[model samples]
Target: MSKGEETKTRILQQAAELFNQQGYAGASISDIMRVTGLQKGGIYNHFQSKDELAIQAFDYAIASISKHYRIAIRSKRHAIERLQALIAVFGSFAENPPIAGGCPLLNTAVESDDAHPALRERSQQAMNSWLNLIRRVIQTGIEKAEVQNNINPDEVATIIVATLEGAMMMSQLYNDTVYMQRAVNHLNHYIENNLKINGTS
Candidate 1:
């Protein structure tokens, strides 16, 4: 990458961490400058405004998490395994978060609910992609006769994602990983006993 491109990328990385750790309202230009070692003019040279930087930073954060998800699920042939792989990624958030603040999707969604329309839309799109991924996995399993035919992919996907997200919030709130562990355990059990065609293990 060229020097300019490299600098822009670095700024995005620093800004993303700041915005995720502190919401759009809480994160200020000074904070970004502090983290990135870039002056206001330097930052504006790349991004037109703080609003623009925030949206791009959010995209960068989402890409980071999506990259982890893609790597985790890519090699698993079985639908259950793929879903489990995704869950394991979430389970790692407590100790090895992809982004420093937490789940970017959750953080942005909550903070941008009414305050920022642009971020709200971006978070919504990201969440839709996640739900669709889960839905596709369940559908594929059903087509292969690997999962129960009666299972509702949409409903199950919501339950799984919501459960994991909620568990993540609890883990962060209480500073205890047991909350996340319990959620992961329950999800695994639900998949085996309820969704799978046969309980293999």
Candidate 2:
């Protein structure tokens, strides 16, 4: 990459970390600049304003989360195993957060509500993408007879998304992983009892 491209990427990476750690509202352009060791003019040369940087930072965070899930799912061959792998990814976050600030999607969603339109939309898109991926995986499991044919992929996806996000939030707030663990346990049970073929209960 060119020097300019490298600098821009560095700014975005630092901005993403700050946004995740503090928040869109809590984090300032000065804070980002301080973290990146860039002058104000250097930051402005890449991004027009702090709002633009916030949007880009949110995109970067979402992409990171998506990349992790993609890798986790790709490692599994079976459709059911892939779906389980996806859930396992979230479950493991309680023990090992992918990013230091916990789930970025949940963080942005909570903080950006009615505050930053661009950032909020970016977060929403990320969540929708995540839900759609889960839904597709469930659909594949059903088609392959690994999951029950009668299962509702959309509903299952919604529940999975909601439960995982909620768990992450609760875990972060309480500074405890128990809620996350319970959420994952329930999620695993749902998959085994509702989705799995052979009626394992």
Residue 73 deviation, candidate 1, in Å?
A: 1.2
**lDDT per residue as tens, model 1, 51-95:** 999999999998998898899988998888988999999899877
Question: For model 1, how many clashes?
Answer: 0
TM-score of each model, in listed order: 0.97, 0.94
Candidate 1's displacement at residue 8, Å, is 1.1
Q: Judge candidate 1 at residue 66 and give its lDDT.
A: 86
What TM-score would you give candidate 1 relative to the actual structure?
0.97
Residue pairs in candidate 2 whose N, alpha carbon or C atoms collide under 3 angstroms: none
User: What residue runs in model 2 are displaced by over 4 Å at the alpha carbon?
Assistant: 199-201
Q: CA shift at 189, candidate 1, in angstroms? A: 0.4
Worst 10 residues of 2 by lDDT: 192-201
